[model samples]
Target: MKKTMLIIVLSVFALGCKPKQTVANTKLDNKTERLMKGDWLVSSVKYVGSDVFKVTSFNIADAKCFEESMWTLVSNNNTGEVVLNKANCATFESKITWYVNKDGNFVMKFLSEGIKAKHTTSGYVLKVANQTETSFQLIDKAAVGSNTAEIVFQFDKIGN
Candidate 1:
C-alpha cells in the first residue's frame, strides 16, 4: 500500500514538472536564421480599419544602425523611398525592434518616421511561422488600443 501511494505521488509530481518545449526550436537552423537577418520583400499588408494593399514588390532592409531592429517599411514618398502600389499611393517607413519579453515571447516595437505621422509606436511579437532558402513568414502579434491582431510578411532573400 505504501509503495502504491509513493508511485501515485511520483506520477503527479512528474506531470507537474514537465518542461514546455516548442517545435520551432527543433527545426530552426543557422542558414534560416541568417536569411531572417537581412532585407527581403514585403509581399502583402493590411491595416486596422484601413484599406488592404497587396504588395507585389517592395524592399525590406535591416536597419543595422540600431540593434534589435526589423523594418516592414515602404519607402517614404517625401523621403524618396518609393515602391508604389498602383495609384492608391501610401508608403510606410515602419521599424520593428525585438527583445525577449517576460512572457518568453518576443517583445517588439513598431515605429515609423514617415510622411503620415512622426514617432508612431506600435508593439508586437514576431514569431517565426515558416522559412526556406528564398522566403519566410513572420507572424506579428500586433496590439492597438484594446484590440490585437496578427500581421504577416513574406520575404525573399536579397542576392541569395
Candidate 2:
C-alpha cells in the first residue's frame, strides 16, 4: 500500500511539473516572411479618418514623410533598413529587425546607431494586410476622439 501511494504521488508530481508547450512558427508566418523579403517602396500613406488627428508613423516622423521611403527586408537574418528620402523631409536611414509572429502581427524594433536590437525593449506591432507578391500594407490604428482610424502604409516591390 505504501509503494502504491508513493507511485501515485510521484506520478501526480511529475504530471504537475510537465513543461509547457510553446507555439511554434506556423507555415503562414514563414510564407509571409518569405514574401516580405525584398526591396520595397512606400508608394503612399492613406489616412482613413478625421484630418484633425495628426498621426506620426513609427514614432519617428509624420505619415506623409513615409511616402516614397525605401525599405529592404532581409528574411534570412530578419534585419532590414529604411530610408526616408522624400523631398522636403529629413533624409535618414534606420536599421530595423522584424518578424511576423504566430498571430500574424508584424513585430518590428528599430535599432539606433551603435545600439543592438536585442537590447531595445520598445517596439512597434502593426497588423499586416492586403499582402501580395508585389504589394502589401501595414495598417496602424489610432484613436481619433472616440473612433479608431487606420493609417495605411502601402508598399510596392521596387526591384527584383
User: What TM-score, over all chains together, does every model reach?
Assistant: 0.38, 0.79
Q: Which residue runs does candidate 1 get wrong by more than 4 Å?
A: 1-33, 45-89, 99-106, 112-122, 141-151
lDDT of 2 at 110: 88
Write candidate 1's Cα lDDT for 49-102 as tens digits. Answer: 533422222133221111222233222211112132323344334444444323
> Mind sharing the TM-score for model 1?
0.38
| Candidate 2: Cα lDDT at 48 | 79
Write down the TM-score for model 2.
0.79
Highest-scoring model, TM-score:
2
lDDT of 2 by residue, 34-83 (tens): 99999999999988755556777878888889999999999888999999
Residue 28 accuracy (lDDT) in model 1: 28
**Best by lDDT, which number?**
2
In angstroms, give how far residue 72 of model 1 lies from its true place.
7.5
Model 2, residue 64: distance off in Å is 1.2
lDDT of 1: 0.43
